[model samples]
Structure formats: C-alpha cells, structure tokens
Target chain A: MSQKVTRRQFLNYSLMGVGSFMAAGAILPMGRFALDPLFQGEAQGSMITTSVKAEEITEEPVKVDFSYEQQDAWYKSEVTDFVWVYRDGDQIIALSPICKHLGCTVTWAGDDANPNKFFCPCHNGLYEKNGKNIPGTPPRGPLDQYEVGESDGFITIGEMFENELV
Target chain B: MLYNQKDLKVLKDEIEFIDTVIIPFAAMDMDMKAPVHAGNLELLQIVCVQLEKQFKGRLLITPPMMTVGEDTSLLGMYTTQLREYGFKNIIVLTHLQAEPGDMNKIRLNEIPLENMSDDMKMEMINDEVKTVMKSVISIWNQ
Candidate 1:
C-alpha cells in the first residue's frame, strides 16, 4: 500500500513544525536567564595563583611577588604586589609587607642594624619574624596575614586577614 | 596621602602629622622635545606614586603642576600659600632645572625608557625612586 498527503495537510504539518522551532528558540534564552545564578556560584572563588612553588618557602621570610587585575575607577590594570612568606614548622605563613604605621613596603633585614627583622626604611619601623611589631617603633599593630593554599605544587593567595600568629 | 577628596577630608585635622607636601612639576612644550617631555612626566608620575605609597602617613602629594618653560614664579606663590596652610616642607619633584625661591627641589635623572626591557625599566625606575626617597629623608632629618 502507498500513502499520499494532500496539499492542505502538508501545509498544516509544515506550519506546526516551523512554529514549534521558533517558539523553542525564544523560550530557551529566557530559561537560561532564569537559571543564571546557579552557574555563577562556581566562579566565585577568588584564589589567585602565584608563580612560586609551595616547597620553596623556608624558615626565613622571603618576598613573593604576585600580580592581579585591579579596577581603578574607569581603568583596569595589572598590579604587581609582594608579601613576606615563610614556613613555620609544617605550616605556610604569608604576611603583608605594608607597614602598620604607614603604607611603606617593608623588607627582610632592610636596616643593617636589624638583621633578623622586617624593616621599613621610612621612619625605621621594625617587625619580628612572626610579624609582631617591636615596641617603641612607629608601627602600632602586627602585620596583616594572607590566606594561602597549595594547588598542584603551586602557591595560591586569597583574601587578607588579621595576623593570627601574633 | 594625596590631593583627592578623601585624603583632603582627613588632611584638614591631621596637618601636623602630614606636614610635608610634594609638588610634581613638569613641562608640556609642544615642540620637538614633546616626546621627551612626555616620557619624563610619565617617569615623574611613577616616582611620585611610589613615594606616596612609601610615605602615606607623613607626606602629601599634590596634583602634577604643568608649565610651559622654566618659569616657576607661580610655584613660589603656591609654596607661600602651602606654608600658610601649615605645611613645614614643600619639596618640588621634577626632571627639569627649577629654582623656586627657598623651596627644596629634587631633580630626577632622565632615563631613556623606550629602548629598555620591562625588567630593566623597572630596575632603573626603582633606582631613581630610591635616590629620590633618600633625598626626601635627608630633608626631613634636617
């Protein structure tokens, strides 16, 4: 047996098929928009990876440079900043290099007299190896700490927090 | 500290702590040396920014002052006004030969930054900044 379709039936069938496709094309975008928040949760991690390895940190603090995209008003630029990192036993600790009194960059043994302390050349501020500000100096508090983690043998930095080791 | 709205607001009551003011002076001659002037201004701005970061608690960086030539008569008037406003030190940072009355001037070295690599440029800029910083510190000590 052979089956044949009339012109009226063919026209009606084609119109329904084309209409369904157009309807789907319009509805899919709206569906995705409604579920957009669910997809954004995965990208909320703010951990920035650094070029240094996790095993490179020693007992003495060393400067570690990290770059990140900074948004300033209408400008977006990559800013490179550094932190003092060291290993305390089995834990990795990272301390902010900004002086507590001012925003000067502190260096490890920057002052010749202060060989084992972080020294700020501006106003002669000093901090111990554990980031505790020395008494009678300009600094009023300990150095701030950065959240650190290791991923694939590389060190990653996250948000800053108050010094917990001090 | 800077000459922005937020810093100025705090500066009103903390003038004693932030007594030093750095005025970045530059020239903008639209002549054959325009590119050289522009490069010098860029380097001056970078050094000013680093100085601000290192001495935010005690130093105030004013806006960059642009001029046409070596005429710095306006700077003298500005310095007098700043002194009246309780600033103990008024240092002019520039890459030009300027003499603004008794105000201190730190002349920066003109480095050819165009033909250098990124690392070399950074090292050169850093060396320049260190020398400028040392001068500022000595002035403070005096």
Candidate 2:
C-alpha cells in the first residue's frame, strides 16, 4: 500500500525552515557592523594645536609649523618635534612633511619650474595641494590628512596611524 | 748643486732619482654649489703648485678630475678615451684618513688628507709624495 503525507505536518516543517532563514538574515549584518572597526585596521595618531587665525590666512597657502606628542608604546615617551600645516578659508589640512617613502621632508614651492607641487629633495617626490601624489612620482601614496578642530580660533589636529597614511 | 760630493764612486751610485706623479682624487656625490673639494676648488689649484714646487722634478701633479659622473662613467667610451690619451703612468688609488689603529693594512694610493690645516694638508701631500717616490725610484732603478 502507498503512504500519504499529512498537509498539517508539511505546513509545520515549511514554516520552521522559513523562520530559521529569517533569523539568520537579521543577525549577520548586525554582527559585521559591530566588528568592522577592528577589521578595518586604521589607528589614530598624534598631532598638535596651532593658533593660526582663520581670517588672517588668505587663499594663498602658507607653511605653518608646530610641535606635538607621540607614544611609541607603554612606558615610552616621544615628543614629535616638527609638523607642517596648510590653511585655505574654513579648510585646514596639515601634512606631515615626512615622506611616506623613507621619512624625508617634502618641500613646498621650492622650484618655479614645477608650480604648486610639494617636492622632496631626497628623491623627486611630488604632491598636489590636496596631498595626492603626482603620477609617476616616487611617493607611492597621498599624504595623510589630520582630524581638525577649531576651538576659540585655534586649530587642533590629530593624525591617523601610520598604516592609515596611505 | 743637488748632487752631494762623495767621489762619484764605482760603476753605479747607491742612490737613484725617480719622477713621481701625485694625483689627489676626491669622490664628490653632493651638489656642486661648491668646488672640487668641499667648497674649496681654488684650494686644490693652490695645492697643486705647492706640490710641484716641493716635490720639484720628483713629482708631476695631475689636475683635479671631477667625479661628478656615476660609477658607470668608469666604463663609458669618453672615460676610456681620456684614460688612453690624457693620463700617463696612471694607477687607481683609494684610501681614507679615518683608518683604525696605529698600524693597519694601508693602501697609500687612496689615502685622504686628514683634518689638517691648509699648511698641514700640503705637508701631508709632500710626505705622500716622498713615500711614493721612494717606491717608484726603487722599482725603476731595479
């Protein structure tokens, strides 16, 4: 004799399978969001404050210098000696004059031959005002941007970790 | 007048005179906002004449050769042409003043003029000439 399946029993099995699929769909995105920061692998770094007045600075860029603090590891103390900042209107972006390639200072407006390009004397590394490296230049990546805050007309900035520099 | 009187003895004299040529070569890698040797090209010219006078006929001094070109210049046709035609009795010498210890393996050819005053620099070159001359004379006479 042939056996026949009950309709009530088939409906219950189908409902349970759909319910489990819905549960998994809700949980996976939430789990990834919570752990994304650690997986992204970018770290915040050190920077200093500058009292450069926004009104005083014009559209013409000028080199601003300052000092900052850095911690290599626990129990290790470092005071970063130098940094360079550029200001245009409400926008203030500071670049570590230090080259990403080998820790050389990239100079600003040195040669009239190549205008508006930051040049590194050690090797022919060039970058535009936005810190994007010129194509075919020795610098493999753009300069790092800092997190900036203007408090009482003084500019404070923080660097992202070296790995984030790219 | 330079020859001393000692009866001009036997078939040959014990002492021999030889002409020695001294070349001071500097490897310059830095930019030439300066001269032949560390912002002092004119100093090299003055040193040349002083060397010629001190060594007299015993030495012939070569003009400064700018090592501005890369090491590949050593193989280039121009370098070979210059070597074949311009320089005579040429031998490569290399040394530094910063050698360790009181006594060590010293190749006199590449020796550096120590942190000496201009006067001392000249004297060092003179002494170098004397040492090299003695060797050159011995080899030639033999």
lDDT of each: 0.90, 0.50
The candidate that achieves the highest DockQ relative to the unseen native structure: 1
The true-versus-predicted C-alpha distance at residue B32 of model 2, in Å, is 38
Residue pairs of candidate 1 with colliding backbone atoms: none
Model 2, chain B only, scores a TM-score of: 0.38
| Residue-wise C-alpha lDDT for candidate 1, range B1-142, written one tens digit per residue | 8999999987898787777999999999998999999999999999998998778878889999999877898888899999999999999999888677888999999998998999999999999999999999899889
TM-score of each: 0.82, 0.36
Task: Give candidate 1 regions above 4 Å deviation.
Answer: A1-44
lDDT of 2 by residue, A1-166 (tens): 9977789888999999999999989999999999888877654334356667645555445555556555666765544333456665567656666665444456676546777877764346787866778888667777766566665777666654342333
DockQ of each: 0.46, 0.01
Q: Model 1 reaches what TM-score against the true structure?
A: 0.82
lDDT of 2 by residue, B34-129 (tens): 333453444444444543433332333445544553342442333354344432233222232332221111235432444568787767667765
